[model samples]
Target: MPKMGFKKLFFFKPSPPPLSVSNNTFSDSLMEENIETARSVITECESQSPPLFTNTRQQAKQYLHAVITLQSTMQYLVERDSSSQKLVKAQFLMQIAMKRLQTEFYRILAENRDCLDPESVSGISSTDHQSSVSDYDDDFPEDDFQFAGDSFSTVAMADLKAIAECMVSAGYSKECVKIYILTRKSIVDEALYHLGVERFSFSQLQKMEWEVLETKIKYWLNAVRVATGTLFPGERALCDFIFGSPEKKIAESCFAEICREGAMSLFGFPENVAKCKKTSEKMFRTLDLYEAISDNWQHIESIFSFESTTSIRSQAVASQVRLGEAVRTMLMDFESAIQKESSKIPVPGGGIHPLTRYVMNYIAFLADYSNALADIVADWPKNPLPESYFQSPDRDGNNRSPEVVERFAWLILVLLCKLDAKAELYKDVALSYLFLANNMQYVVVKVRNSNLGFLLGDDWLTKHEAKVKEYVSKYERFGWSKVLALLPENPPAEMAMEQAKAIFQSFNAAVEETCRAQSSWVVSDPKLRDEIKVWIASKLVQRYWEYYEKYRGGLESVIRFSPDKLGNYLYEIVLFRAEESGSVSSHSASPPHRFKRS
Candidate 1:
């Protein structure tokens, strides 16, 4: 067996008798007395029916100390008399005590497995330096390892650390380490099994159906969270507490070997998922996987810090890269779907198109993961858009990163461009304008209400708001231009009453036709819709009312609407509530007609 270093003898600090010995004879007598006391302690523990640790912890500590003291005396005898029978007897006693201590160590670990489980150990503060074996008392006091309370886990961990230090110190490290590795490894493996982590080949994952694969990805997400946040760290702490003293490499080496297989299986799943078929719906799940890995990366690096576990670290990083590629590719496909939208059918009532709804919904969902996406697409270049096209560069209070801001801006621009193409399918120029306004309003509202507003910034919202207003203005101008044309430019100094009647009759027919034709047109944004109605009333109603009053004496018999009735007509027709209200008949509700015989 390889020699266990002297540094492992944590409790073997022996101070000699403080009193001055008169001669070598007196000192020799003192040494023999100390050896006799140690031999007595060892013999009593061996003769007992119960194990030393289980019977009484103080006795266990005494037996350990006695064994260590015997080993030291044997070394002294070897130097003094290389062939002494006394040396043989001391060696025999030392081996017998070591064998007993080894059995006690194994029993403590096996019997207290639950006490040392990961979830319980993880609750112990990492900053609690008092819990380390370095603080152990040489005399093994009852309260030496008790802090908050004499908790079961606290005592068990303390006992494990004390035995580990003693066994390593006695040069029986090989046996002690073997028992520890086997027992702790079982716990780690079982914990991973309950977490639902399973190793899979690339072909198996790639060939699996998405429904099955998605369930596995969900399991992986939860597993990665618990494993990194609790399980792995707790195991690492336990290993360090047991074997970290005077040799940190042992802790790192044991930890690397113990957690290696489980961690690789845990992290390797994402890379295989990223390699599977890419779909629009799968993008968020892939991002979820990426975010999970990204979130726990710091703890992963610390837990598997050993050079031997470098492959696990590399596998995690590779999964991130591949997941990133998957997201980027899905984004490209979404953009392509927008560009490839071949529908020539104009949406009825000039309402929101399906393409508009799908793209906006997709983009809004993507906005929720803007920060994670910023890292994924850090190297993926943005589609080149004109500087003037997307002008919200200043994100002072914005939480989203610039790359994601620009990326979302480009995607929205693509959707708008697609909507612009679909608008051309409308035969009515006025309805086309209303189509643009409705879809633009939908996009602006989606951005304003979701995380996209914070990412795109107020400037982007203001720009799109301006576009919606422009569409509303064009729709009003084209839609009601003919009706407005029916009114005279000025109040005429008319001579004949017949011409005056003709003007009033033409005005009445034109207003009714305009209201009836536009009753079917739709505006989805309530605020914008009401604004359009008010603007139209201000322009058309006030002008037409003045014309009606001027011609009332000659044309009142033909007059069909009063100014108040005209305003109500505009409201009902614009809202398409004329049929619901049963008020679409010719203006029978107008005030009494007054025609003067001039």
Candidate 2:
């Protein structure tokens, strides 16, 4: 484990008073005097020695010492007179001490805020609002890490721990947690204000998040654990303070903020998984949240502490029989959002957006943890299977998983279905076919190349490859039919000139339309792309070649368009790259033209 930034502050159990002292009789006057001074102890803690309480650490140490002393005196008196008026006095003073710490910490930190982090004083706002000022451009100095000059941390950490100890020692677990919550809010708000958290870059946000979690929060949790976990059966415990009844006690130790906005909300996690997935910029945000939360959970798990990070990671996961309910909740929303957009995603002019590959890439990412995803589906309510299972695969020989579908596999299948459906909307059939071919080919290759193949079981790629062929076959039909028109069965020899003119017109139209349109189209794979260009070229040139020779009788007859010009026409129609459009000239060579990958 990496060393935490904060100095280690261990919690210790104070030994009980000697038996001789316990048996000592207390006069009513002395007992009354001790109870009267119990409240005054808090005042004397600061008043008696002003210098001792100057800094935060000093104030906390003395503050805790006074609280403990008052409690002991109060308890001793209460034992002799179980319903003493002074005991009530002692209780009120303890509450006063708690209130003072809470109020003073806020004020002291607020006043000295500039000394801790000047930038934060400006950008950090009230907890209710998130600051939009970005701290991204600032170069954080290494001095920020050493924290040698930090007057606030010393006071906050020490006093916070002291108060928690005093509370736990007095059997106030609820107050202990409340103290922790208040201390956390103060520390987090200070850091956030300083870091301009609301507008932090990803790198800055992650750096500070880990620092706060592993150090400050870690210390607070450890202190509470030591206070609560160390008590004997008769002694009061931290957990006891939290949940008094056995039935009411929960295994989880979630904080207020975690129960509300979640642990990552402070780190700028988007409002929801569905929201993050839809905004292309937030594409990887949920995955990042999962990873961060997962790691923090491990950090806590190494010990026995369960806290905010657990809830953050676990919020999406459902319990009950559906252990994977949380995972399904996050992923299912993503599936819905992506599928909705896939059909609507316009094929840009002749080019495909990188988004076409995102679905499969994300699937590959999901596939990395296929076992986890599979577990979720394995436990879903075993109602009758949805109709999606029986629906014939959309032209892709791929069918739904016959067994409980792994989340990743199910999502990928949905994407494939969407891709196929989207392809049908392209106004240009050849372009639509190319888009389908590109996406299908990409999905197949990605699955075969990654562990996605393992999760999806056998024949995932083979089935999608069959879909690619279906697309290719459709493309060939749409593209080649135009070229086939160039050789219109038989030309009447009776009206030779008129027949020749009609063939030339049809030939020009087909050549220009097919070439110009296809030249701009994209095919994602190198091998498949080359195969497509060759396939189209072969069909076009073979028939054109025969017509050119028979009609050319070598230009003895007046032909308006030259046979040599066919090469120029072919060259212009096959523009490959956007960059090559400026320089490429028409073909002067023979007509078995195979184009390069665009």
Task: Indicate which candidate wins on lDDT.
Answer: 1
Q: lDDT (0-100) at residue 41 of candidate 1?
A: 94
Mark the regions of model 2 whose C-alpha exceeds 4 Å error after superposition.
Answer: 1-326, 342-345, 353-355, 375-377, 381-405, 488-505, 556-598
lDDT for model 2 comes to 0.47
In candidate 2 the C-alpha lDDT for residue 423 amounts to 71
Candidate 1 per-residue lDDT over residues 231-311, each given as its tens digit: 998888788777877566767777887888888889999999999889887888898898888888998888777798999
Per residue, candidate 2 scores C-alpha lDDT tens digits across 1-598 of: 0112111211222332222122334565565565556556666753553433343344445456666677787777778776666666666666666555444433444444344332222222112121111211123232322223253543332333333445656666554454344433454444443333233343443455433422433333233232122211101121222223222232134233312231233323322322211332222333333333333444323222334335533442321113233355656567776667633545643344344456666667665544344444655643342443322223233433323334555666677667667777788787788777777777778888987775555555566688789988987788667677667566444447557666766777767766677666665577786677666556556656666667766344444445445544454447333313212223221211211211
lDDT value for model 1: 0.76
On TM-score, the candidate that comes out on top is 1
Candidate 1: where are CA atoms >4 Å away?
1-43, 77-95, 123-150, 392-400, 553-557, 573-598
CA lDDT, candidate 1, residue 369: 85
Error of 1 at 377 (Å): 2.1
Clashing pairs in 1: none
